[model samples]
Target chain A: EDKVVQSPLSLVVHEGDTVTLNCSYEVTNFRSLLWYKQEKKAPTFLFMLTSSGIEKKSGRLSSILDKKELFSILNITATQTGDSAVYLCAHLNDYKLSFGAGTTVTVRA
Target chain B: DAGITQSPRYKITETGRQVTLMCHQTWSHSYMFWYRQDLGHGLRLIYYSAAADITDKGEVPDGYVVSRSKTENFPLTLESATRSQTSVYFCASSERYGGRDGYTFGSGTRLTVV
Candidate 1:
């Protein structure tokens, strides 16, 4: 079965600290890796990485896919209170996605 | 604005009852999907349709049914509700295969089974 596992299930950090969330996957046909941030109602898209060693970034948030290592990492620099949320990582095959358990990060001011 | 939307943002039902969650996308995307969100599990796929009149089972399809008779509407029905089915449901759409482009999700529907 395809499996996606995330580490550091929960984290608490002070504002301006840097945080790293990890995700490892084992899928039949690896297509892509995606990241999302969920606040309350629904999850919002973050980044999608297909090629290994290439990093996708948006503002203070960035992600990189390591196909050779079968994992991905999400990094948040200069974290703020607003960055507190559940970060999800998913592995895609065909049109379906297998998601990790998710990492909850809480940034306190 | 053009995006996917789900009806019945919230629902409360009893076990053994029938419930249907509605999903519609104004963009007329070729692909639509249904997913259930539970605490700690993130989101799990329930069903998906590649186009009108085409549908397939996903990770968790038991006790659930889906139909896409039209390109814009994909509805998921719970034949017999169960307490375990109580969770947030989300609808997503994409113009292309989701592996590369990803998907756009609706606001989600919170279903509570009593």
Candidate 2:
């Protein structure tokens, strides 16, 4: 079975703080790893990492995949209230996605 | 209007009753999928269709049924609702199966079984 595990199940921090989320996966025929931010309804796309060492960044959020270690990390710098949400880590394997329990981050004002 | 949509944003039903969740996409994507989301489980695939009349089971397909007679529509039917079946269901569409671009998801339907 494909397994994806995320660390720091929950976190609370004030605005302007930097937080790092972790995700590790083990699966065959791995295609990519995707991150989704879930607030209330369906999750919205965040980032997709496919290569190792290469980083994908958007604004204050950045993510990198380490294929050799079978892990990935998402970093948020200068967090804001809007960044408070459940961060999901999903592995794309054989055209299917296996997701982790997710890290719930709460940004306090 | 241009994205995927799921009907009945919220529903409440009794156990053993039949319930159907509808999904429609205007993108004309070749691939469609149904997923259930719970607190502990982020998202689990229930069923997927590659095209019209072509459907397959996913990780959690039991107690559920799906049909894709039209390219833009894929409806998931639960023959008999159970208490454990209560969860938020999402519908997603993709131009290709597991394309690098990823899938586009609907707003989701929240189901409550009593």
Candidate 3:
């Protein structure tokens, strides 16, 4: 079975602080890694990392994949109170995605 | 106007009843997936379709059924609703395969079984 694990299930940080979320996986056929942010409703897409060492960035959020290490990390720089949400990591295959338990981030002002 | 949508944003049904959740996308995405979310379990895939009329089961498929007769529509049905089936069901679609672009999710349907 494909499995994805995330560390530090919950975290608290102050505004302007940087936070790093980790994700590791074990799958039969690995294709890519994805990150998502969920507030109260459906999850919104964050980043999709396919190659190693190449970081995908959008505003204050960035992510990188390490295929050799079988892991990925999502970093939030200069975080704001609006950045408080559950961050999810998923390992993708041709058919389905295996998701981690998710890291709940709480950013206080 | 060009995104995925789900109907019956909220539903309430009794145990042993039958219910169906609807999903439609306008992007002509080839892959559609159904997932259920709980408090701690995150999102667990219930079923997915590669294309029209080609459906496959996922991690949590029991007590559920799905059909993809068209590329833009995928509906999930609960044969016999149970208390354990109460969850927030989300519908997602991808342009290509699973690994290309990240999946686009619907607002989700909150189902309550009493």
Highest DockQ: which candidate?
3
Model 3 interface CAPRI class: medium
Off by over 4 Å in 3: none
Q: With candidate 1 superimposed using the best TM-score fit, by how many Å does residue B104's alpha carbon deviate from the native?
A: 0.8
- Clash list (residue pairs), candidate 3: none
Residue B5 Cα positional deviation in candidate 3, in Å, after optimal superposition: 0.8
lDDT per residue (tens digit) for residues A15-109 in model 1: 99999999999999888888989888677889999899999889999999898999999999999999999998988788887888889999999
lDDT per residue as tens, model 2, A14-103 = 999999999999887788999989887778888989999999999999999999999999999999999999999999876578889999
Reference A-B contact fraction recovered by candidate 3? 0.80
Off by over 4 Å in 2: none
TM-score of each candidate structure, all chains considered together: 0.97, 0.98, 0.97
Candidate 3 local lDDT, residue A20: 98
Alpha-carbon lDDT of model 2: 0.92
Instruction: Give the TM-score of candidate 3 (chain A).
Output: 0.98
> Which tens-of-lDDT digit does each residue in B17-99 have in candidate 2?
99999999998999998989998888999999889999999999999999999999999999999999999999998888665
Alpha carbon lDDT of each predicted model: 0.91, 0.92, 0.93
Candidate 2 chain A: minimum summed lDDT over ten consecutive residues — where?
Answer: A90-99
Worst 10 residues of 1 chain B by lDDT: B94-103
